[model samples]
Structures are given as structure tokens and as C-alpha cells.
Target chain A: MMLLKSESLPIVSEQDIVRARQVARQWAIDLNFKLIDQTKFVTAVSELARNTLIYGRGGFMLLEAVEKDLRKGLRAVFEDRGPGIPDIEEALKDGFSTGNSLGLGLPGAKRLSNEFEIISQPGEGTRVTIARWT
Target chain B: MERIPILRMGDFLLVTIQVDMHDRLAMTLQDDLTRQIVASNSRGVLIDISSLEMIDSFIGRMLSNISLMSNVLAAQTVVVGMQPAVAITLVELGMSMPGVRTALNVEKGMMLLRECLDSDDSEVEDDAS
Candidate 1:
């Protein structure tokens, strides 16, 4: 997808996740996506945003409006400088939790987007990128 | 702190989550519902998420907590008004939200709560035997 515009929000607090969902929903609507699609984006942002705040030990999210093959969509990249995941595959398991949660982290967000990717280092941090096309 | 309003409807407490629920708000709802259920001695709770566009893992767990808590308090909880899209997203997200009773709308949700209350009564009858 070709980038239209991008903005970043800090994910250090729970309030940030709320703001991320709001911004993602507005972006999805601006792209003329349907309600369900917008909801999907908002929900995915909530999940990843939480991961960034809790697991990442504080990070930021980059929101991008993009166009792909003449279709508009939204992309979000969450980056955090915390203890990175030791095992990406196990983290994606449906009921897996490294902490106290449902553990529907990476997998759930991946399902909501048209494109999803994650990059992480053992002690550095983690970055997850996801995009949805209408 | 913005509180999501909870309305009392006879033996049922009605909570319409009309905000973009964050973690704190979801937790607050869980606490408030627990207190109201006990204080009012209500038999059922109907949580309306029609206006809610999203339910993350934290909020999803809060919903389940409310159900389990109300059950222990001798009250049944019914979640309703989940948008078609939200349901699809939850399923795709792999939450499935086991043990959380749901219905299409508020009216139907009340009906489900009543059914549970009826079953509770039947159980009491069996205990009397």
C-alpha cells in the first residue's frame, strides 16, 4: 500500500489504547470502510495497543492511511522497548499467555488485518505491523 | 473518571456500555455490577453492548468476570446487542467467549435472563425435594 499520511501515539498508558482505537476508527471511516471493518480495526488496535503498553513496557503506535491497488486501508505499527518475546510461535497460540490474559495477542490481531508482520529482538524490543484494505 | 451508567430495571440491572471501553472503565463496570447485584438482590443482569464497537481481551475478560461473579451472587447475566461485525471479529480473534450468554437485542436479552432465572427456580424446587 502507498502511504497517504502517518501519525504516532504513545502506548504507555491504558488511555493511549483508547485513543488508538478512536484514531483507527476515524481513519477507517475516512477511508470509507464499512462499520464492521472499522470495528475490526478498532478492536485489533485495542489488542496490539495493550500488548505494547503491558508487554512492551511502553511504546508508540504509528497509524498510516494508505492506498493499495486503488483500495484504501489503514496500517498500524506498534513498537516497544521492553523484554521481547522469546518465542514468536508460542506467543501466537490462541490460549497462550505469558502473563495474566486470554493470550489472544499476535494471532488475533493478525486475523483482523489484511497484512500482519512482527519483528522482535530478545532484549531490545518488538515491532508489529498490520494493515487492512477495503 | 467517566463512569458508564448502569440503570436498574426491576429484578434486572441494565448496563448499556455506551463508551469506547478502556481497561479502567471495563473494570469499573465489573465492580459496579457486582455491588448493584448484591445491594438490589437482583436475580439477573443484562449488559447491552450495542453501542460498543470493540471488545478487547481485557474487556472480554471483564464480561466473563461479571457473569461468573453474578452467578456466584445468585444472579444470571446476559450480554446482548453485539453487532454482527463484533461477533465475527470476536470469533476471528479466537475469543469465542465461552460461558457468556448472549442474545440479539435488549428485549431478547431480558428473555434469556428470565429463562435462566426460571431454571434457577427449578433447581430450588429440586433442592426442596
Candidate 2:
């Protein structure tokens, strides 16, 4: 994958979540993603960005436009230096949340993306990367 | 500190969500709507979400919360004008919004609220007899 362009946005406050969604939507539109695809990608960004703020204790989101295998895609990486997850599998389950939310952020975001990846450790931190292709 | 406005219209409260709501704003709207419903003695609440291009679980929960809260305050809530893309995304995100009532647009939502209120009034009258 080759990075064509990229930008980073903070996820310290609730307003940042909305900004993340807007940035994702614009990137999806630029990629010529279908309306539904754009909505799906942006919704995924909202979920992950919130997790980065609430669960991760404030992080930054890295947005990237990339080209891979002759296909264009938008990638977002949310990284936080908070208490990490001990059980990655459990954290990815629907309705499994420790933040008093609906517990759909991780799983829902994974479902909405073409590719999803996560890395976490008990005392370290967590990083989630999601990408959607047009 | 931005807040969504709730307008009172003849026994109903009208809310048009024209901005991309942050979490705090969504919660604030929920609080304001419930308060307005009681203060105005509204029989129904119509929420227009046509301008919202996205509906994450947070906003979905906020809508459901508003509906549930209004019901407790003797007011029926009907969500309206959800974009097709948003509807599709909400469903796929594992949020069916089970107890929340929805309509195609503002006009239909108003009609549905009126019907619901009418039915409730008739039921109350029936119980009184």
C-alpha cells in the first residue's frame, strides 16, 4: 500500500468525534465511495474515535488515502495510550463494553470496514486501524 | 456548548436535527426535549433527522433514550426523515432501535404522532367510563 495523502486529528473531546466523522466522510467522497459506503465508513470512524477518547483516554486519529493493488482506499488509525485490553476477542464482541456504552463500537466498526486490525496490551495501550475501499 | 432547539407546535414538540451532533450535544438534546415535553404538556414529539447523514450507536441510543423518556412523560415520540444510507448503516451496526417509532418524513411523522395521541385519548376516555 502506498500512502497518497494523510492528516492527523486529536480525539480529546466529544467535538473531535464529530470532526473525525466529517473528515472520514470527505475522504470517502473523494475516493468515489458509494453513498452507503461513505456513510458506513464515516459511522465506523465515529465509533472508533469515541473509543479512542473514552476508553483510550484521549488519542489521535490518523487518516490516510492510499492505493493498494490498483484500488484506492481510505484508512484510519486510532491510537491511544490508556489501559489496554486484556482480552481482545471479548472486546470485539457485540454488546461487550466497559465504557457504559452500547458496546457496539469495536465490532460495529469492524463490520463496516473492508479491513480491520487491532493491537493491545494489558498495561500498554491500544491501536485500531480500519480501511474501506471504493 | 451548542444546543439543538425544540419547538412547540400545538400539543407536540418539533425537533429538527440539522447539525452533526457531538455526544454532549446529543445528550443535551435528550435532556431539553424531555423538559420541553413536560413544560409544554406536549402529547407527542416529532424528531426530524433528515439532515443527519450518519447515525452512530451514540446518536441511535440518544434517539432511543429520548423516545423512552418522552413515553414516561406521557408523550409519544416519532423519529422521521432518516436518510436511507443512515438507516442501512444503523441496522448493520447492530442497533435495531426496537422500541422507537419511525416515519418517512415530517408530514408522516406528524400524522403518526397525532394518531398515537388520539388513540391514547380514546383509551383514557374508555377507561373513565
> Which candidate wins on lDDT?
2
Worst 10 residues of 1 chain A by lDDT: A90-99
* TM-score quality measure for candidate 1: 0.95
Q: Estimate how well candidate 1 is docked, as a DockQ score.
A: 0.83
Cα lDDT tens digits, model 1, B1-129, are: 789888998999999888887788788889988999999999999999998888877888899899999989989889999888888888888888788999999999998888888888999999999
- Cα lDDT, all candidates: 0.89, 0.94
Q: Candidate 2's error at B7, in angstroms?
A: 0.6
Q: Which residue pairs clash in candidate 2? A: none
Q: For all the predictions, what are the DockQ values?
A: 0.83, 0.93
The list of candidate 2 runs beyond 4 A from truth reads none
Taking all chains together, each candidate's TM-score versus the true structure is 0.95, 0.98
Candidate 1 error regions (>4 Å): none
lDDT of 2 by residue, A2-101 (tens): 9999999999999899999999999888889999999999999999999999999999999999999999999999999999999999999999988789
- Output the lDDT of residue B50, model 2: 97
Q: Give me the displacement of residue B110 in model 2, in angstroms.
A: 0.8
